[model samples]
Target: MSISVPQLHAELPTGCSVDRSGFMRRVSGVQAVSPISPPRSPVPLRLSVPGRLLAGGIGLGCLVILMIAGLVVPDSRGVGTHEQLGMPACGFLSRTGIPCGTCGMTTSFSLLVRGDLPAAFRAQPFGAVAGVAAGMTVWAAGYIAITGRPVHRLFRRCSATWLVGILLGAWLISWGWKIFVVVGGLVGG
Candidate 1:
């Protein structure tokens, strides 16, 4: 079978003629035919102002919790505030005598909230990053909540797989750094 497209004829002056070529494509026993491209869907619509405000409000609430936890709890000097909060100690540390990935996170965040950057990093680099991220989120979310304007669209175009991979990679790197810090401390002190 073959498909054909209609030809167009236009009137022109003498000796000025338009040449017409047959527009047909053979469709018999095609070995390698290019697949038809699917129509692209539009970007999903973003949340409205009030909807964004609601989301931001929830984020701000989480930030508030982090802030309150930071303020009310004191840094345990890498021991973490989990015990102070009536939580069990790190099981890995208790059994294997090695710090876990999140062992000093609470202490790191608390120290960071107290404006001790070096101490925070020494406590847990990832926790310091988490504290900073929480603060930034609080600020951005508050702005979105109050003004109803979308803040930076940095990750608007990021795919879920990319985002998850980035996050996991960061987590792994941070965990490795945490282990290195802990081992260095043990060796130095």
Candidate 2:
């Protein structure tokens, strides 16, 4: 059955009504009725040559800053020692005995800085992975800012099942590692 827009509006839940022109209108309330149109497909903005260049420069600068911070930072082994410096390890991992996934990240980064990839991997495999991910993220963000196109769109299109599976897998791996460490300590002692 074909129903008029106004008729559909009138049939809305209580306290909601429609205007004479068949648009949603609030008769008496603090909330104002604003008619919203369906979102249109975004058209690419025509940026000036200088504007594009400026964006590219800014992106490159951000990438440089990220790399400097990630690779040039000195390592220390004290709880809350480098808290003010935004170093990830000094906050929680040092205080707690449990080794976080990124626990030896600073040492890993330091090893990387000293051109010891093997040592970095030995220090913390997860940290090495994180460092690579962070580098890629910075590069992708910079590239997007300059080119106006996203480098990694896979995350945007990920399905719920894929996310669930990833989370479950990570949890299982972490739990298994913890169990192995505990069992190894018991056997050795």
Candidate 3:
């Protein structure tokens, strides 16, 4: 039996598939037919046209967020930067005399825009992490959109549940850190 040339798919023209006994060998830039081969490193995932469109949209969204951050001035007080956008003060802090979990996030984003990483982290750990995440997403999306390649191992190894759990854990930890900093007088305002 002989291997056939590529066949178009509803998803991608180069979409991968494996037959029983796994005779297919996907090579760099193209798939090929070969004898049974030893195990190799994971192959990068090829993006479908829709996937590329989504990636472009995601990159654009992240860039828009960063641009908005650049427009805002980081508050020296470490919080209340959202007020500059005509938002009211934190009602939780005002009524309960305690900073909310997300307090200082806006200021952190503003500091990130100014390239003051230390100040951004100081303002809000979550916000700093979020800024970095957004930046990375923009980079990854651009790469995927341009090259039609995505880090396959990452997506293959992690499930949706696992990703959600990690995000939840990080959020909780950041919120706790914020509360500690404010209560310990380490944070100003």
Each prediction's number of clashing residue pairs: 0, 0, 0
Model 2 residue 17 CA deviation in Å: 26
Looking at model 2, report the run of 10 residues with the lowest lDDT sum.
74-83
Report residue 109 deviation for candidate 1 (angstroms). Answer: 0.8
Error of 2 at 57 (Å): 11
Q: List candidate 2 segments past 4 Å from native.
A: 1-97, 113-115, 160-189
What Cα-based lDDT does every candidate model obtain? 0.69, 0.52, 0.80
Q: Across residues 8-104, which tens digit of lDDT does each residue of candidate 3 receive?
A: 3233234354445543434346654455887776865588999999999999999998888899888777778899889999998788766788898
lDDT assessment of candidate 1: 0.69
Better of 1 and 2 by TM-score: 1
Candidate number with greatest lDDT? 3
What is the Cα-based lDDT of residue 41 in candidate 3?
60
Better of 1 and 3 by lDDT: 3
Using TM-score, rank the candidates from best to worst: 3, 1, 2
**TM-score of predicted model 3?**
0.69
Candidate 1 wrongly placed segments (more than 4 Å)? 1-50, 72-76, 157-159, 183-189
CA-only RMSD, every prediction: 9.8, 10.4, 11.4
Per-candidate TM equals 0.66, 0.44, 0.69
Q: After superposition, how far is residue 187 of candidate 2 from its true place, in Å?
A: 19
lDDT of model number 3: 0.80
Model 2 C-alpha RMSD vs. true structure (Å) is: 10.4
